[model samples]
Target: MTRPKTTPLPPTIVVVFGITGDLARRKLLPAIFDLYLKGLLPSQFRLVGFMRRDLSKLEFQTLIQDSLTKYHRGASSTSLKKFLKLIVLEQGQFDDPAAYERLGEQLKSLDNSLGVCTNKLFYLAVPPALYPTIFPLIKKSHLAKACESARAGTGWTRFLVEKPFGRDLGTARSLERQLKNIFTEDQIFRIDHYLAKETLQNIITFRLANPLFANIWNRGHIVRVEVRLLEQEGIVGRGSFYDEVGALRDVGQNHLLQMLALVAMETPATLTAASIRAARERVLKGLKLAHSDFKESVQRGQYEGYLNESGVAPYSTTETYFKINATVTTGPLRGVPFTLESGKGLPVKKTEIKIYFKNLKLIPVEVESGEVGNVLTFTIQPNEGVALSLLAKEPGLDYLVTEKNLEFAYATGWPDRLIPSDYERLLFDALMGDSTLFPTRGEIIASWQFITPILNQLNKLPLTRYRRGDLPSVS
Candidate 1:
């Protein structure tokens, strides 16, 4: 595929709400610096770090330098110095009104220095609990509005929100209402970093562009779909947060469902954001648990040492692992079963989608009963690649069948290509006003509608216990 032309970006100011947070240090700041290195950011760009920490300008710069060095290695000293020049720190508490006023003044100063109204991208990198506190303050400070008095409203404002959008449907709806009151639908960019991964995006392109796969992507040709997101690391420092959230809400509702939608949704009419999101939303709306009884379709498990983890309750029923069987009731995927599983502290860290194809019974060649059919896999992480497993005759006189893997890895297949990190691609897309990689409000709501019911019945279902590295029993 030919590379698309890069468009010039407008002069903009990015205001990161929680600059001291882990996400900012690890992903957001690193991504922004990468964009700077690539000259994707405009010459008049500025990154305003909004946090309560009162540090000197030099101190803030040093901290950011350390972060870049740790998270983004091999950055040249010259580039680091140039990037640091764009950093501006705003010391303020989330609930402090005076702090917001000062931030407004700082933004005005930035605009004045540019001699024109600049676009603003506010990144709420903080936790969801602080969203309510910050949302009203932004509106009260008139930060969401364009500068009509100073300039003729040439600038646009966008909000980038991270996910686990909400705990459940009610909370998600409430959050939507809060955001709607403050910002318009188009102004809101709901970040689902998974959607921005090269491999994930390729799923749509691979299906649509390749006639070989597209022709057979349906219930008739496929058997069952499996979307698995497994992690090898435990909740080490995040026990408090993890204990409350568990695996289902943390990934099942967002990542797993999103991947399943991409795998099952019909070919979109066009490749635009509207068409793609509409296709996903339709699949999400039609999804339901395969069994009415939650226990029959859902399995929950807690890691063996979860109780000993810091901030976790001794008798906590929170599930660190979950496996769900869901079915699509509409479209061409009707009656197809999708196994969505996610867990922490597993033996391996992997995120992939496996599509099983029906085996051909008409063939005269003898095949073992244990031999499965062709399996097409989209590996999202650990290694970004796609592989198709097929039964082939073994290299011997006897006609024995063995599974052969035809793999395409991004690293080996495109050695010189610089694949952007999930956060990097997402941040760049947000700046370019491209919402194709982000989730829509309707998609979020539809996902929650399907997941909320299962979550509600989770308490009644007994939680199984398994060791950290062991694969939990599904039955």
Candidate 2:
């Protein structure tokens, strides 16, 4: 199979805030290096790390080098050195205006030196609290204003925000309002990295580009849709944050819901970012909230002995597992049931979406109840691939049938292919000014609108408890 051609980006500089943070060291920097290794970066590109530490450029370089060595030691030193040469470090406090002013001057100096209206993409890899302060500073310093650079379409400025876009509906709206005041809608990229996963993006292609699947992707042919993101390990060290955020906000509201949108949304007229987001918005808006019977429609659970974990409140009721049954009220999938589930400390770590199609025809022989048949699954983890389950007649004279799986795995089917991590693909898109995979404000608001009611009624519902490795029914 031929890979899609990547459009070459113009000369760009990525300014990463909170450079010393764990995400930068583990995911962002390694992804940047991988892009360089794949020769996907622009000819003239640089990385600027903004932090509060008082380390010299060399010391900062050494710090990143150590981290790279620890996580990506297999990287060739020759290429690693080349990638490192493009990095420059600047030390400053996040809330200080002088720091941003100085950083802006530095960026302007680089733009002048390059003789191009250099595109700047600021990655707010910092905590959520810093957003209110950082965005205004970015605008005030003239780093991302809707001036001649962005207006003329010669150069561009974009903000790549980290997830948990807001804690709830009101907070999300407030953040959106603040962002609107600073940057245009087109300039903001609210990232949920799961959307960039190879299989996730391929979902649209699999449905729209394939006649067999597209024709049957409706309520008439499908029974139900299930999206699950399960993990086996409990919150090891992030108890403080996880306790407050819970599994619903940590993964349910964004990742699982986004997957549901992709599964239930109507096909768009085109494949542009706007078109895709519009489709998602329509599906999200069509979601039927489980307000009156949320206790029955929604379920929440905490793992056994969760309160014994460090940093958790003794009487904490935060849910570590969340599952909801939702319905789409419009489009071809109107009336179709959809289940969104996510939890930590489950039996296994897996992320997959299953489309259970109605058995249009009866079997030639008797069959047992509670048996699965005619299902298509997009397995996103463990072994990333697509699999379809079909019934096949046993090779005997008697009329007998059994379940069989036809599977395609990235590791096995495309052994020679190298799939980039989610971060690499998303970072590349941000550099090219592509918002196709990023979450829009409308989508976020719609998601919150659907989830806020459940959150408000949490106090009324009982939080179930199970053992650490036990698997709870999520159907």
Tens digit of per-residue lDDT, candidate 1, span 1-475: 2225466766899999999888999999999998888888877899999998888998888989999999995788899998998888999899999999999999999999999789899999999988989999999999999655425434889899989788899999999999999998888999888898888899987887899888888889888999999999998799899888988989899999899888888888888888888999999999998887778899999889889999998899999999999999876678999999999989999999998888877564455646478889999999999999878889989867778899999999999987898888888888777788888899999999999988888988888899889999868
Clashing residue pairs, candidate 1?
none
TM-score each candidate. Answer: 0.96, 0.96
Model 1: weakest 10-residue lDDT segment is 146-155
Q: Quote model 1's TM-score.
A: 0.96
Worst 10 contiguous positions by lDDT, candidate 2: 363-372
Compute the lDDT for candidate 1. 0.88
* 410 Cα displacement, candidate 1 (Å): 0.9
Give residue 202's lDDT in candidate 2 (0 to 100).
82
In the range 201-264, model 2's lDDT, one tens digit per residue, is 8899889888989999889998888999999999998888888999888998899889999998
The model with the greatest lDDT is 1
